[model samples]
Target: MFKLFLLTSLLFLLPIFHCYSLPEPCSGTCVNAHDPSIVIRPNGTYFRFSTGGKIAIHTAPDLRGPWTYKGAALPNGSKINLKGNQDLWAPDVSLVDNLYHLFYSVSTFGSQASAIGLARSPSMDAGTWTDLGAAGISSDATKRYNAIDPNLIYVNGTYHMSFGSFWDGIFQVEMNSPPTTAKSNVQPTQIVHNSAESAMEGPALFRYGEYYYLFFSKGQCCGLDRSRPAAGKEYRIMVCRSGVSTGGFVDKSGRACTNGGGTVVLESHGWVYGPGGQGVFQDPVHGPVVYYHYVDTRVGYADGQKRFGWNKLDFTTGWPAV
Candidate 1:
């Protein structure tokens, strides 16, 4: 019965081998992807939504893509009736109840007169979205938070959103429904901020094991040609973790996230420069993966093109390592 025992052992080990295999990184000409949010379809097709050019859409059959451009998600522009609302930035997508919900930022660069607009599609495809107008706005002169870089996550049966850029780091509000809108009664809580610099944005939240992790990009972004920061100081990814979903986030050294405290998650290495605008997704095969855009210094920053970057996350030591 040795052959029978050998066959049984092989079958048991097959699934374990498949689960631990690392995913192939995105390859080929990956360009013009900024502030990207990636989602996988039921059939395992990859759909990546990004900032600028009216929220551009790109698709690939696998992670290591022969990625194809699929045109703009919002061709006619936002229905918010703002002057510079056409150029959408930082679109976050999630599928709920058979509907694909897209939340994007509408504003002029460096202006606080901004709103986060909502759009939906039955299928997460380009040119199929219907804009649902303003989900939230930050038009008041006294308000410090800018309504941009929207990231939505479901925590403990409640829908919560963490959004804001530059002025006040990241803020969180409980959503009344999935994908769009927030509860009117609960005010937005300032969850993470950096006091050392006025540069903080692109807040992405992911829950791993018993703690919730907050990932955000800090330092100057864009205009690399005119004024690039010190070699290693340009846009970089930082992270903090909290036991509760809403507040009390701190870095590995026990420094509060609201007080300029963040542990560097990923930064520039060699040709990769200014890596930021990050989002985390759980791959069915490869566990947790971090997706973001980084400028290729080899191509020169003046070219104004950003490429997609992703790495599998390891939490074996109790904190995420790429």
Candidate 2:
């Protein structure tokens, strides 16, 4: 009777003590990814770009393991004439015309004074990045949008750069053929904006099949301990879809994305607290994959130590499921 009681008590306390110990996505010394953007080379080498340390770069064989941190993408820092250019954020890297084009945000936290800068590298190796000043997007007190967290999307035959945060939500503008800069249009069109919550950002657009999917992070991001938000107000991955690439996005509930409508792709549950800062990629083997950075509360709540996460998406139901 004593042995049975002890076993029953241990089983009851197991869930309470080990509930947050779910499978972690990464192995090795890779718990340092924040605002991570991953791109695979032709040879299947995974290059992960992230914020801070002049946009830290990491490479790994599989998403689940053995990530080795190479040095910063721009070790010498950015040439853009902006305050705190060395402490870059939100790097969006894409392979264009045999060159890796990297777009990063140059700004201070919370202030609207920001600019998105560009850099290029032939192979994404450290010490190969050449800063190209600004990519034609700048923000100030007078502007309605904050120029940060850039995500570039190529749709149809035109190239578009989607960016913005806090002040406006999300916006996109057309880029030239080379995508060196946004067109001379002074303003970008808004794609997704939550006038009520007013806390959407990190826009990533992916075109699959007949629809264009817009994935973004919504609610309060960061400060999980210092300034933690209410339960439902924490960061989570949300998504919407549009038939065309130029706007008219709607959620799975037939609600427009402009008015604070987004279907949740991944949210805080179990130990996955505030999973966001997401980007969608078409993997060579997994087809569609969504990668993001989420704070693992079982670890620490510091912003820079967030965990890098990825999950294969199932779109057979016309909506993406993890």
Per-residue lDDT over 1-322 for candidate 2, one digit per residue giving the tens place of the 0 to 100 score: 9999999989987744322223346786567688999988888788999987888988988777588988899887788877878899999999899999999999987888899999999999888999998999988999888999999988767899999898768998899889999999646988888888888999999888899999999988887768888888899889999999879999999888987779988888786888888889888876788888887778888887788888888899988888
Query: lDDT for model 1, on a 0 to 1 scale?
Result: 0.83
Instruction: Return the lDDT, model 2, position 52.
Output: 78
User: Which ten-residue region of model 2 has the weakest summed lDDT?
Assistant: 15-24
Which regions of candidate 1 fall more than 4 Å away from where they truly are?
A: 1-24
Report residue 22 deviation for candidate 1 (angstroms): 14
TM-score of each: 0.89, 0.91
Maximum-lDDT candidate: 2
